[model samples]
Target chain A: MEYIIISTGFALALLGLWGILSQKNLIKIILGFTIFNTGINIVMVSIGYVRGKAAPILDVIKPSEAADKIVDPLPQALVLTAIVIGLGVTALMLVYALNLHREKNSLDINSFKDLKW
Target chain B: MIKKILIIGLLAGVGLIFFDLFNAYQGSEVLGKTGRYYAENGADEVGAANLVTAVIVTYRGLDTLGEVTILFLTAAIISFVLKFRREDFIPNRPVRITSELLDSASQVIVPVIFMVGIYIFINGHLTPGGGFQGGAVIASGVLLMIMANPNFGISHKVIAKVESISGIAFVLIGIMGIFLAGGFLDNRLLGLGNLGELFSAGVIPIIYTFIGLKVGAELSNILGTISHAQNEKN
Candidate 1:
């Protein structure tokens, strides 16, 4: 199960890379970035998965038996933080795209040649 | 054509690296030392039934503060970069009227969404959802409101007030933890209450509430800024 999820994450990450590399529109590139961020989050979560273990919540399982009952909590916590940070980063990227579009009146990456060599 | 070929070659090289990393990953049979300790003692020590919440809100709380600061900086930078005079704006484009279904549905659904968002953050200690998730949900609600009415304007003064107040309160609670408990951002400042109860987990709920409010305000501020900036297109 973990392997399957991990593989799926890798696939998504690769797909995102393809999008980033080939896309001409700034918004599409930002979408690729978000997809890449999500793929990484998924891989991190799957790494923390314990086979046949429940979620890290102790609602049903007693606290004494938590070690054997729950999956690792550290990655889940880290991923939670990552998800929030990703949201912030995505918002910032969109704002940047908006400004870029305003400046050039074009969303195509090829149109902006001010910094091109 | 050359650029496309180069891109594919680069991606193939990256894919091979990923494949090698995947091959070497041996799934762990047990939790690491830190994870094991948290799993065993997290509920008892933090009085939060959700172990992930316990880890995020207390065990590694300073990092959470840093995460919030980063979010604040993102919002600040976006606002700074997108600054424009509101009064000077004029929308020359034809206004698109919202559909009747959406217009009516948003009126009924927005309030419910806000309520659910508040509930998620308030029950952070016992549930899978927490402040960030709740804040995002609330921001979605705000987005829906804007979709329903393009003329809708979120008051900058109100959102700024809420954001700053909640952020200051979050820091204040962290400082209180230093004086009242083990160290900074300690959830035990007020003593852990009954586990699985709404009011349990010492200051976790309070801290999460502030975080939720601050995040929601900041995100709403971002959305409002972007949407208002759209008027410049006209």
Candidate 2:
């Protein structure tokens, strides 16, 4: 089950990378970035999941029992922060894309050849 | 042709990385030292029923501070980049009559979403949801309202005020932690009541509430600015 989840994450990441490398439209590239972010999050999450373990909440189990029953909380915490940061980065990228479009009247990566020395 | 080969090579590299990760990941059936320590000590120390909440709010409080600032700065940068152009400030959008059904439906939905968002943040110390998730939900409500009725807009001043106040409160709570407890963002400033109750987690829920409100305000501000910019173009 872990293998399946992890593999899916890797596949998603590769697909995103392909989208980013192949697509000329800035929007597609941004979408690729979001996909990449999701993939990384999924990998992080799946890596932390143990067999038949619960979330690391203290609501159910006693503190002593937590070590046996709970999945790793560190990865979950990191992913949570990463997810929020990813959204911010995505929003910023989209805004930059919008500004680029406004300036050049084009969304194609090839349109701005001046950047390609 | 070269692009195809390059893409394939990249895919092979990615596959190798994943394979390496898979091999390297030795699945632990039990918590490691850090996890075990938190598991054993967190409830008693942080007074939060939810351990994840304890970890985020108390254990790694400084990181959360930096995270919120990143969010705050993103909103600021977004708004700064989209500063008003006088000609476009009036929003030269063509008058498309909004349907009554859509408007009324949103009127019903927005409040419910807002309430749920508040609940998530308020119960951060007891449940799975927290400030970030709750704040995103609330921002989505604002987004729904904006979409349903183009004219139904929130002022930048209102959002800015909410954000500023909440952000100040969050920092003040952290400062209070510094003075009242062992270190910064310590949840032990107030008495740790019974673990499962609403008021049990000393200052975690409060801090999360502040975070939720601040995040919601900032996101709503960013979204509103972006949408207005879109409207200006059309």
Candidate 3:
């Protein structure tokens, strides 16, 4: 199960990288960045997965058995922060894209030659 | 053609690295040292039903503060980048009239969404959701309202006030942690109530509440700024 999730994350990440590299539309590239971000989050969560373990919540499980019964909570916490940060980064990227579009009146990456060598 | 090929080559290399890491990773049968310690002692130490919340709200709380600061900066930077004068504003484009279904449904759904957002953050100590999730949900509610009415003005004054007040409260609680409890941002600043209760984790719920309000305001500010900017065409 963990392997499947981890592999799916990798696949999505690769797909997102392809989108980022090949897409000409600024919005599409931002979409790719978001997909990539989600993929990374998934991979991080899967890394904490323990076989046949419950979630880190102690609602049903006894506190005494929590160490043995639950999956890793640390990664969950780290990924929580990562997810929020990703949202911020994605929002910033979209704002940047909006500004870029306003300046060039085009979403195509090829239209902006100011940074081209 | 060359660019496409180069891109594929780069992706393949990255994929290979991922594959290598994947192959080496044997799913652990047990928690790591830190995770084990938290899992075993977290409930007693934090008195929260959700270990993840215990970890995020208390154990690594300084990181959460940094995360909130980063989000606030992102919103600020977006608004700053998008600042335009009324004199420079282009003529407003034709606003699309939302469908009746959406218009009416949103009126009913938005309040429920807001309530759920509040519930999620309030129950952050016992549930899987937390302040960030709740804030995003609240922002989505704001987004729905904006979508229903393109010209819906979210008062900047209100958003700014909410954000600053919550932010100050968050920091103040953290300061209180130093004086009253262990270190900074300590959830134990307030006495930990009975586990699984609504108010179990001392300052976790309070901090998460503030974090939720601040995040909701920041994100709503970003959404409002961006949506308003849609009217300004060069």
Best by DockQ: 3
Across B116-221, the per-residue lDDT of candidate 2 in tens digits comes to 9999999998889999999999999999988886656679888988999998998888898888888788888888899889998888888999999999998998
Residue range with the least summed lDDT across 10 consecutive positions in model 1 chain B: B86-95
lDDT of 3 by residue, A7-63 (tens): 999999998988999999999998998899889889999999999999999989999
A14-117 per-residue lDDT for model 2 (tens digits): 88888898899999999999998898899998877888888888787876677787887878888899999999999999999998888899999999888688
Interface RMSD of 2: 1.6
What's the candidate order when arranged by decreasing lDDT?
A: 3, 1, 2
Residue A9, model 1: lDDT of 90
Instruction: Name the regions of candidate 1 deviating beyond 4 angstroms.
Output: B85-88, B91-94
The local distance difference test score of each candidate is 0.90, 0.87, 0.91
DockQ of each: 0.82, 0.67, 0.90
Per-residue lDDT over B30-100 for candidate 3, one digit per residue giving the tens place of the 0 to 100 score: 89999999998999999999999999989998898899999999999999999887877655557888899
TM-score of each: 0.97, 0.96, 0.97
- Among incorrect, acceptable, medium and high, the docking class of model 3 is high
Tens-place lDDT digits, model 1, residues B15-77: 998899789887777888899999878877899999998999899999999999998999899
Residue B10 in model 3: shift from native, Å? 0.9
TM-score of chain B of each: 0.95, 0.95, 0.96
